[model samples]
Target: MKITVTEDQAPLDYDQDQVAQQYQEAKQQLWRSRIEEPSLMRLIGDLRGKRVIDAACGEGYFTRRLRQAGAAEVVGFDISERMIELARSQEAHDPLGIAYRVEDARTVVPQQSFDLVVSAWLLVHAQTREELQEFCDGIASRLRPGGRFVTLTTNPDVYFFRPRPDYRKYGFEMTLAEHVKGGAPIRFTMHLEKADLEIVNYYLPLTEYQEAFRRAGFRDFQLHPLHLAPDPAGRDDRADWEDFLKNPIMILFDCVKAE
Candidate 1:
């Protein structure tokens, strides 16, 4: 299936070097370093000898980690040219043997099937139902039968039901208009040390997400909550992380292609 975007449906750009750099830095922030990465890696457990694709792989951060986790082959794809360039530069510097390409997740043409397809913060970019379905279809096309797809995305429940300004403590803020529905635009701002980065994502109800997955031939879908990385000091609870835990901004979706 071919997925094309109309003029008004164009994707948000991270083609600027500064934006790409800020995005890479944002990954090192507490929420991502502690909650997102560890939980996502755990969900995608044991990739030894598997072929993996990191769709919408901004700067190839997780792509490198996927390779290190024993995937025989790993490829990173992103729509942003600057992001891909940064990822390729990192590969050149570290010699990870990973390949990086510029491609949109909603309309990607995979060269070969993969054992796993992983994305971080990709699905939220879909501005319409058709685009959301295209994203799912593109992912399904990249995977072999029974291959798994795992992604981290905005938790709609929290975004809609528990919207709050307290997220500033975690170095970011989310703003949404009242009575938001599917396809409503969401404003996400990251307060970095030196600068603030803002990006837009669209809201789609959970039901819509499930429908799209089914239409894309995925089954056994599951939603996994984010887990805070274990404290090195062996402390069970971290007071600072309590609010974020109660109202997590992100969650994981795990599903498999139907045979």
Candidate 2:
């Protein structure tokens, strides 16, 4: 699945047709609804009257959701053409005025600066610091000065991902080893049994992300680790909710581009 890269470019793994298809279907399932979407929506606040770029937006799931949630304008971009195609098809069936395009978040060519840019599960693929900064810079490039940016990312701490009964039942496992120090690269594998998919992500210290944000002229950064959203009173049968609090899978970032 490796593709030729320029001397300065980072390796990308999202362009595969099968991965794109699997991920598109995966997002529609219950895990996305209960686990990540609520936390993500809360972190981004009200999108009403704001133009938003759904960076690395897969299959336009959140893109359409943003529109339904009151965004004035929504545009979604992903590196995979297959993803964009699926998104476009969904948009065609039920047009939400969302525009889908193919573009890498690390090198996006935005049509116009956005009031807000939100990325979900996107930055973990950065294998190097420069790639991480490029992601931040690209986000900065797409935003108006003083624009807001929100992200859901892999928690860098790997101490919680050891083999466990819970992981197997959930159909995914994040395998980790000796932690690499000094912002060095640590490759982590997330194997999804349900999707029959395996995803590789980079694990770097949180300081590395802060530096990237600072270097990209982002300020007032706030990090919120993911927590389980409470269910309605009717659904009192909350199984496996405690694990989300104990070993939160993702961290949410709320940041602003410098004016």
Candidate 3:
């Protein structure tokens, strides 16, 4: 959907939503599990009987999951009208009691503060550190005092170190080994190699993120490397994956709003 923007504000185009949906559609994956399972499962497990907000919740796929996980109330907010429409359409059958709304991440005011807020892959494409801080401010604003915020983003170390290419390309041999991972064919084709596509990502260091959270009145924050080991002994060639888990392409932030 075309985002409405005034001269003073930047366009919060739902381009990310469209590209993500298109990629997922091409890959046939309903949601990204491998990347999401580690932190989300950890975050949701603590959310039973609590009010939860799924910020930047594209399509409400995981929003429905939050309801299933026993949240007292689940509200999924995204900036894309089409995404919200489609999410609602999918929930028309049983309606998992999750509400989906179209609202800008930077400006939308929550109906009420929530006990737990989770934003996934929303900060990866940020153009600068300030934008990431703005996102942090937004998350901080929607939390109840002493509430927790869980967000996932591209690993700054890995994102900054990835090789860059000057030309467009496609196709690569993926090994579940080394620092590189096989980009599984999902609704979209995300290559294992970084240089093939133009990625506008902010390499916001951990210290910078921590300071931003501090300024937002969040303390006692922890950064966990979002690395998952493949089923051990089940896959023989998984030793490389074990080592790769030391450093991953994603990072999860678990923080608490000061009381």
Top candidate, metric lDDT: 1
lDDT of 3 by residue, 164-248 (tens): 3211122211112133322211111234322222223345567777887898789999876554434435665444343334445
Q: How many clashing residue pairs, candidate 3?
A: 7
Better of 2 and 3 by TM-score: 2
Give the top-scoring candidate (TM-score).
Answer: 1
The worst-scoring run of ten residues by lDDT in candidate 2 lies at 1-10
Worst 10 residues of 3 by lDDT: 180-189
Rank candidates, lDDT, best first: 1, 2, 3
Q: Per-residue error at 240 for model 2, in Å?
A: 2.0
Model 3 score (lDDT): 0.62
Give the C-alpha miss distance for residue 188 in model 3, angstroms.
10
Residue lDDT tens for model 1, 67-116: 99999999999989999999999999999889999898877466457999
| TM-scores, each model vs. reference | 0.92, 0.85, 0.72
Q: What C-alpha lDDT do the candidate models reach, one value each? A: 0.84, 0.75, 0.62
